[model samples]
Target chain A: MDMLEQYLPFFTKLTPQQQAVLSQNTTRHTAKKGEIVHNGSLDCIGILILVRGQFRVFTLSEEGREITLYRLWERDICLLSASCMLNSIQFDVSVEAKKETEYWKIPASVYRKVMQQAAPMANYTGELLAARFSDVMWLMDQILYKRMDSRLAAFLLEESQLEGGRELKMTHEAIARHLGSAREVVTRMLKYFQSEGLVALSRGSVTISDETGLRKLAEESLR
Target chain B: MDMLEQYLPFFTKLTPQQQAVLSQNTTRHTAKKGEIVHNGSLDCIGILILVRGQFRVFTLSEEGREITLYRLWERDICLLSASCMLNSIQFDVSVEAKKETEYWKIPASVYRKVMQQAAPMANYTGELLAARFSDVMWLMDQILYKRMDSRLAAFLLEESQLEGGRELKMTHEAIARHLGSAREVVTRMLKYFQSEGLVALSRGSVTISDETGLRKLAEESLR
Candidate 1:
């Protein structure tokens, strides 16, 4: 069995003929770190199932500011790269390889054909789509309802957790891109946090100084 | 032909057997104005297709702040109502009757069965899902990239165009909910707009005093 079959919902239920078609269509692809795996304008990139590494999905402003929509981990399937082949996706969403990445790509036509053929496959596609919508909605809720201070505090904590330490080696510009904010705004807020003894800021790094205080500030947006 | 059939992509291509099952499952339902049509906790509400009037889809914060995701006008179909049945969708999304509305409701089980049986129906669902993802992305773009002044200006201009008049009869709280901001923030922006001679504000109403100036302000966020 092809490794890609693991990612498919009830793959065994697919007719042997259908399975072979998918196997033929699925191709292994890789991208170097920082490479754009999918450009918004480039249509029909197809369904990407990450086998290893990470992908950052984001929207880029005209001024080149980027706000991340979500990140894809190993085993995550990206139906978004195939947006044009689907329909009515009016906004631009680009995906970049955040690290050296390996994935399996299935052309949109084959995926559509297989999905239409199998009930499980179609349901799987719907599930993926609904999941993405939920992520976007959740982010919107945070940005709209949570104060910037709360969001920034939560983000810093999130980074610290991901890096497995209190000290984060991330520049203000990098933090702003992830939070979908301006670098200056992030810097000003970090300074405020520093003054309040919540976090200690140094050149290109932020260290969790007052863990309890920072956690309380971040708790506002935690839910 | 059932009116519901018209909404389905390639309805004619569906086997007559499938068509009959769909028609049997779909039923017309109506809601009064301001009615909560679908609560996030209620699962398997299935899909909603608006026939007449309007629906507002939004998220409610714990603090009672509301941020609209998008609205469903006449002939729009809503899948978020059926989130639980679809899978993942870990966040809350509620829908309400913005006005007295009539719609066709197909139970999640039936829709899933039909969609799996028909390729065109599955494609149609995919299209709708992609379109919605685009809408959410666009809204996120506006909130992240555009300044509050630009957003407020755009919102006022949008209201004027929607009402077909310069005078918009809405409270500050109402504007704040739609814009996903605080009432104080909205009031402050309105006052600034008024001071700039861009708009005239009165009790529960705002009149666009300078259309050209307003458009220019709104234009920054237009694209």
Candidate 2:
């Protein structure tokens, strides 16, 4: 199966006739690092499904701070922006390629038409949206109750699990911005981790040396 | 025009035709103050639409602290228990009537059938859920950076506006729980507000004397 076929849900469940219609409507694109797939002011387009690499979904505060709301990877669909197509509302969050990424952008009009004709597709979309709602609620809980250090640790653990690697290609500034904290604070924390032999940091990169120690720190700081 | 009309988005957009179907299927109930509409373990059989009075949606943390997630008034459809309906997942939050309330409960199966048959109703429900997603994101932002005092002030402003009155039916303990702060802290802040001639407080109630002043306090504390 191709990238789009592998990533899009309900494709297999669709009748061959239905799949042919969708294949004709969907377009694939490659985004370079730092390229924005969608901006807050953009007109509502179709949902984008990440096929390869990573993207960050974020919004700017009134005070000009960038708050990271979600990290999207392979097989994840961006439904937050999907509402815009139905209501004519501009996208509220921007999607940027964190690395060289491939995604299938399906037009909302075609998707709607297909959904109208295919009950399974409509149900799948609804289920996908409901899952996103649950994930947003979970993120809200973390923001309300989890400390910054613990949140940062959780972020690292999540990324590690996603990429299946200890080495992280992220700068302290990037991590700090994602955590909604100051770069200096993240730098100091990284130094502390290094002294404690929990992590090794080099220029613009970090490798976890002790996952168990990091988990302990996360639990301790969460309390 | 009835309570069913107000909650048309929850099931299907009620045409004069479909509206009649809903009126026949739904049952209305009066929830007394402090009544639990749905607990954490209850099977979610239907969607609940508040027709009158108020309700609070909260979840208890592992440490046994109540975290206020949402407040619902007339015409608001509750979706926190949606996961229970979709996946049979246990509800993590509890819905309780904050005051004597009237609501209509429609079975989940019936609601799904309506959406499948009615395009307008599907679109309306989609829009409502999208707005809810936006609200959740805003609340996450508040939780991340806004101090407890600012959150409390914002909550007061929101609730007061909803009531369309200066007098709010809430106690300091209630406000503290909503703001995720200690009761003593809320009491101290109310005293500060009273000293500044911004509000007057009594048991179970507070009256805003200076709306502009409170708005300013909320904005400043948010910074």
Candidate 3:
């Protein structure tokens, strides 16, 4: 399938000429599960418009601890990868494929040219940038104000919605990385949740049994 | 001075007609020390270009804890205040005057129109948005990976840089709010710093006696 054809719905406001320039210059790339796609590169920067699979946009500490800034799903657009567009951007975020993923990569120069000529595209880019800022702020708030149990509960709730069911099929290690926590901490919290009868743990998955209890615990910090 | 006349250097990219519209519509506002200037207003959103004094951009929790996201000094441009320009921005940040401040208030509608008409202005806005993202991400990284002592040390170092002195005049309570910590915790850390001869504590002030030691302590977590 043509890359532009797949993302035409996303770029609905683009003129035909602008779309042609982007479609011709935007390249498609694929990554296997657990592959690091973009690192701290100075020259190679552009917008990543996800067409399929998932991405973990995260930061890795010098000590090697991982904390996910956020995740990107189908149709989500990322701008941190295009940090070179702004010399003032000192963000050091990495994008990793959580699973087999494919996306269109629009080079920064091409996007810049198109954006200069297209008001809709520029506005859309601005809005995307704004949304990402909101997501980062929300994450910071949760980490600062919310307790570990509250954060874990909220993450589980978010995962349940994404998975479309009660059971979450992820390891404690993966969950720890997502929450910027230790695996032992996550396991201990899971045990506490089980004791409270909020969730039931299986070999690799945890099922929510008392969602109301979990919800309250998740929002306990706010109150 | 006219608001536009004062900020003309910042908006050098604007066309003369665009300048006329923004200059005519932009208003100047004043805030006393410790006054709330912008709350959660959706309608009154716009760019805040500080001409003098300081602004603390931060978030407040229901429990009344305050954690500063960043600060705006003389000549700094803030886009989060103009968040209404992008409907996707869900950042709920408030601005407070750290000191008597005078700034230009470019309303969202006027700023949006000017941005759409001027490519340079649009690009500059994008870069500012990107820089803010970097600031937020850096704060999150510190909170997640760095220990309380390291974070406190780093905060003091930053304050020193901002104040251009080894002695800081901030109270422990004010310092705690900035670091998202408790006043008791900040006091305890100060005592430790004093005991180690790294700093000298007097009534309502902490003076750094050993800058190298403090710098090392500030960066200990990253190493």
Best candidate (score: TM-score)? 1
What docking grade applies to model 2?
incorrect
lDDT of 2 by residue, B1-223 (tens): 3656546643343466667766777888899998888776555647788889987877765566565555788888876544454442223678889889998887777776766566555555555555656655655555455555466777789989999999998888888888766687688667656645688988889999988978976785433
Q: Residues A1-223, candidate 3, lDDT per residue (tens digit)? A: 2556565443656777878888888888898998988885533568888989988887778778766667898988877787776677786778889889998898988887888766666666777778878877766775676467788999999999999999999999999999887797689678757755689998899999999988977885453
* Candidate 2 deviant stretches above 4 angstroms: A1-22, A88-91, A113-119, A219-223, B1-6, B9-25, B41-45, B88-91, B113-122, B145-223
Evaluated at residue B131, the lDDT of candidate 2 is 62
- Ranking of all candidate structures by their lDDT, best first: 1, 3, 2
All candidates' TM-scores?
A: 0.81, 0.73, 0.80
Question: Chain A: TM-score in each candidate?
Answer: 0.68, 0.78, 0.64
lDDT of candidates 1 onward, in order: 0.82, 0.71, 0.80
Q: List chain B TM-scores, each candidate.
A: 0.93, 0.59, 0.87
Write the number of the candidate with greater lDDT, choosing between 2 and 3. Answer: 3
DockQ for each model: 0.61, 0.19, 0.60
DockQ of candidate 2 relative to the true structure: 0.19
Clashes of 3: 0
Query: In model 3, which runs have C-alpha deviations exceeding 4 angstroms?
Result: A1-16, A42-45, A148-223, B1-12, B41-45, B164-166
Instruction: Compute the DockQ of candidate 1.
Output: 0.61
